[model samples]
Target: MKRVIYGLFNRLRFKHKLFLSYLLVIFIPIMVLGVYSYKQSEQMLNMQAIQGIEKNVDTISESIDGSVERYNHTIQSIVYNKTFQKIVTNDYLDLVNLSYDLKEYLTPYLNMMVMLDKEIDQVTFYTQTYVPEYGDSVLSAARVENEQWYKDAMNKTGSQWFFEDGLFVVSKFPRFFADKATNLVYMRVNDDSLFKNVTDLAKDYSVAIADEQGRVIYSNQSASKNTLDADALIRMNEGALMVGGAESFLVKKAVRQTGWTIYCIVPAVQVSPNVGSIINATLIIIGACMLGVLIIIWIFSKTMIRRIYSLNVWMKRVEIGDLRMRIRSDSKDEIGELTNRFGTMLIRLNELIDELYRNKIVQKEAEFKALQWQMNPHFLYNTLSFINWKALKSEAYDISHIVTTLSKFYRTGLNRGDNIIPVRDELEHIKSYIEIIQIMKDYSFDVTYEIDEAVFDYTTINFILQPLAENAIKHGINRKTTGRGMLRIKAKLGDRTVEFTVEDNGEGMPPETAKTIMQNQCSGYGLKNVNERLQLRFGSDYSIAVESIAGSCTLMKIIIPQNIQS
Candidate 1:
């Protein structure tokens, strides 16, 4: 049998295998847990119902005890009252005096007792002395002498409760008056006030207050012939009972003030009425969980199989030499990751093939451009030197000086095609260009160089300063009208950086022009080119900044790192 089952499982597809595994791992366990939970819940609900019945019995007992204590205290108060003793024991001379004594002392005292306690229905005084009937509050003892409760109270020493038609307490008063005139204080309470708590319980529940003799004094349930035996309930104390041939839950609580027991009986079926519903709900939940498991397994298997098949097709294309195929998946699962990796591999393979051939072509072009660039700078320098020599031979000394300065400027600007040069060489290049400008303009503008000697040790991008000086003379110094055009070049050294400032006393450009001068095409390539080269070589931290005041002065500052390698 095991072999047969294994063979059948092995023959199934992956999705079928996964579905079977889910049933074994998830569905069966859920069903078992559902059954176990139902059994536990039923037991717990039964225990809770029993506890609730017990609690109700205790509450009824406490309420009855409180009423009994209150009645006993009231009876004691009446028995010990001096005015009540005087009114009952006084020898009346005539009917008028009797009426006056009753009205002035006895009637008001009884009325006060009843008014003070809302629970006390009426207080009646019964006396055997020849006192005419004075309403129900002063009743004659001759009327109740034949009553069993009256006989019992007279026989007893203290207060006694009698549950006849209604609940009442009887007590003999004026113990000091030993004359054999029967005197008793009778207090009656409304029956509803004693049994109010029990009436709020469920109809199926029966509550009974049983005296010490085990007779039912009060019961919320109607007195039927087949009522539960209160004697058996008191003796049994608690647990199961039989009511009308049906098993019931019984709870008993003792009223301490009165030697009575409160009995609460609940039908067993009422204790856990929702047991069937719990079983049905558990079965429904198990069915839902099993159905959900099957659906999830199916969806998961279908999605995984589809993605794997797609990935296989892509791999097949790559195997057949097609590297341009593209695929994308937004899922973050393992299969999606594998698919993405495969697509990336194909793309990188294509890029490497193109980059290999393109790099070779770029290498040859760069070599040719390097050769061309090398020839042009040297040829221009040689031509400039030749012009200077000719001007010297013609005794044109100023022309020769201008030509020599221009040659020196171009030589320092090229720097053998290297972008980085010492600070001294950069200064020399800009100085040579400025000398050429001064001679051409006939020394119109005064030039000052306040260069710190320590800055010559650092390195900077070549040809950066020459263009700024040229812009200063052409745009700034030449436009000055009120004062002599002064051009100042200052270099300062700091802890980790070097700063160069180019200032001019020419008619300075507008604030807006200075702000956008580097970005504007009409501003020419000198400042913009220098800014770009400095930024590209040393990042934005070592770029040029322009600050100008219209009609006053224009200042261009260049900052560069001091520790740069030459």
Candidate 2:
């Protein structure tokens, strides 16, 4: 049930609801007023028509009654007068003479009464017998030998009257009669202007004259020619002659005097016409408003959601340690202000990260300087004292050579404040160390230098090459079989780089020991430091490698750029 109700509400559009409301407001009044107007117009027109007709008919009836009384007096004079009785009794003067006397006596009276009756067309006279003398001078007798009046009058004569439609005057004398009379005098009456007068008055009414069965006899307003069902017509009826026939109407009225239906038939459909058009226009306006509202809402929501999403992305980046991330927005709303704050926060975070990075590099640089400072002069001083004592006893000229080399060694090893020194300087320091050891142990060895003259200007870190060379001579030369030993320092250009190889023929370690020296970089801090410093100063590509064969020699290779300067 809840689902059903939700669907129904969704299907009912806002414009439809609004249009429904407008229809209620406008059409409801129109419907009510239309119904009321129809009824009232019908009754009003019908009642007015009936009242007017009743007045006219009453006037006609009164005039007719008065005229009939006068006619009866004239006829009584003709019927009972002494002159007519004597004329008939004597039989000397014929009935024709009596008719002439009667006609002549009645003419002025008939003319006056005819002029008085407004509905009368003309006046005429008839007698109990045909007589030229009794007729108007311009007319002759039109005998009605078989008329009902003739038959009735021949049997018994008095006065009677009846009405007929479409009656007309004759060119010749038309017989006047009682309802049925030829043996008595008669008069003719008519209302020629009655139809015209009634028609003129009906112009003001929405009036129609319908038969008792509701067939239209005449209508005042023919534009809205409305037809009525028998029952619908019955609503307008009160009595036998009351106005009737109001079927479909916009406004209606009744005539009180006649049974005619008067319809102010504004079409029932015309009552609330164009209602749909009004509703359509209302719906269009409402729809436009709603569309504008929706567009505004969508644009606003999109901007807001986009700002939130951008902020979310920034937050995620910050969480993941990217302090450079920032949210950017141009809106003047709260979200834009929040993004501005976030951008400030990112700036602060980046500043903090940069400070930490700088501190780390500073500490690292300090540590590296400390590691380089680890090589001490005191150990060399004590070892040189022992070499001095040994040289004095031997008193060999080579002792002086050894001491002189020692001085050069110390000079290059502590190369003032300079971190890098010339390669030749490093070679001289190695020669001194080897010479001093030879003076002490009397080791027999041959040293040779094979280096390019152009490579002589290139500089490397102080004491870098000498220590590795010392390790080779002192440890490698005595450990081997008793034979001549050779120390060779060779520098050659290979491709774009220079290869500096220190080769020695000694009791060499196995390939595994060479492997250990190559791979186990931290095994000797001095060698490790030298290699690291060389790589750090130059690049990782500029570095050291050790190669050896069992019982032959070890070769240490140092590669650097051929064109290396400072």
Candidate 3:
């Protein structure tokens, strides 16, 4: 009998099958049992509402504490910076040095602090001694000596928080400098950032932030008649409260960094609607269940049909040689699984194409190696060394030196067919290239190396620096018409990376020309080849960066991971 019923069900149309399923599965059960379920749901909803509001208040408190901690860290960093301490503590006998110090150190330091932390609106230093004010950053102590907030900060030993004119201000004295205790550092927090979480609450909900002494600092419902009292909420902790003769839910959380409290209140009526009205609505809903079930079945059938049609369209596109076509569905049904499988197939096809392209590159590299073997590099190096010795014996010193340098350049460049070598070798190769250029150009340009000793321990791709040095001399230094051009090469250790820069002070190109120099074939093949090789070896993240100013200078920077292996 079960098999017969299943066969009969399978014979029905799709919409008819959906109709019967909804009627037998949903309509009858709900009509018989929905009344009790609706009454029970009301109590559960009220409990959930209370728990949700409590969680929201806790989250807001945590967010505010996080902002406060970051602000405090910024303040400490500024107070401990050596440049800041020197600027404040120095007794200036000459205004010339003071002006230079402020311009060279203080201005840049303060600007960096402000840039690093977006929450800081302004940073100002107050000094007791007579000094010329540079801008809003430095001011005389007399401007705020009479103010209560400034006086409190002067007497305080640690950081203090205060609210003035809607801005949150942090003030402290530098503990390391005893004689400069009266000197103060004030960092003002952006007002919008401090109260962003509080203002995000629902319109029916009220939020307030207050100090330890119960003075309200911020209130989202300040202009409304339903604003909560900060002191009353603090005393009550968590419970129901009477506001304007109506009961409201109240929850409070304390900010850990600043000794402040966050208070949240909402009307109790909003938590759960009237239960009687809900029961009356349930009876009407039951009367309409049959029609509702039919409507739902129609909507479900149409939705499934539309999704299936979309999948069919995608399949057709894929069949017509459009492998990139894709379709997405959030449904957990069989059709959704089929669509996901199709997307996976497309990805596999693309991967296969990429593999073929890489194989071609490898084949070409093998051919190039076969050509390199045709010429014997060792015999050439030996011939050059013999000629150098003959020239030195003949007292032709310049020819001998040139021959020696040329041999060195080729030995380093070949590097036993290895792609990677020590940074020291690469530097030596560039030095050889530079010596040859200086001789050819009659020493018209000056070259300087400011390499850090630590960089010699790292390894990089071979023949990278020689091309960059060649470009600097051919394109930059040789174009200068005035004084002797300058070329500087620098290498230093960075955070988990090594940085190499080649800069030349000569005729430079326009900004647009510099921007496309790497991609433009006419600029030079050397720069583009270097960029592509770095990207292929490391990743797209490691590449060469170019900066230039017209008629001034040009700089090329290459950065790579310090821990890279050969």
List, in order, the clash count of every candidate structure.
0, 24, 0
lDDT of each: 0.79, 0.57, 0.78
Kindly report which residue stretches of model 2 are placed more than 4 angstroms away from their true locations once superposed: 1-396, 518-525, 562-566
Kindly list the per-residue Cα lDDT of model 3 for residues 1-566, writing each as its tens digit. Answer: 99999999999998888778767788768766776767676878778999999888888887887778777777877777766665665557788888888998888887887797676788887877667777988787889889877877777665678777755555554655356435677888886777776677534577777887687788786314665566665676577777768888777788887788877777788777787767876777776776777788778867778888888888888789787665566778999988888788888987897798688556644543554455679898889989998999999999999999888987887778767788888898898989988988888899999999898888997767877888888889989888889999999999989899999998988999899988855443378777777876787898888899999899999998895444
Question: Mind giving the per-residue lDDT tens digits that candidate 1 earns over 128-178?
Answer: 887677899788888989998888888887888877777888889865646
**Per-residue lDDT of model 2, residues 1-566, tens digit only:** 99997797678866545544554455555546545554455445555544554554444334434544554564465556554433223323566665565556556565665677554554444333333444442122245546654454445434443232332222111223421322334445443343344345444333343433455444444432444344555455332321233333323343332323443332222223354544454556555655555555455546556768878888888888777665666778888898898898889878887788667655644665675467666676667667777787788657656766786677676665466667677667776776776677676787788878766767666656765777677657767787898888887777877677888898888877776664455444457666766666667777778888778888888887655565
The best-first sequence of candidates by lDDT reads: 1, 3, 2
Among all windows of 10 consecutive residues in model 1, the one with the lowest summed lDDT is 363-372
How does candidate 3 score on lDDT?
A: 0.78
Error of 3 at 495 (Å): 2.9
Better of 1 and 3 by TM-score: 3
In candidate 3, list every pair of residues with a backbone clash.
none
Q: Which regions of candidate 3 fall more than 4 Å away from where they truly are?
A: 1-13, 37-278, 281-344, 347-351, 360-364, 367-375, 522-525, 563-566
RMSD in order of candidates: 22.2, 45.5, 15.1
TM-scores for every predicted model: 0.42, 0.35, 0.53
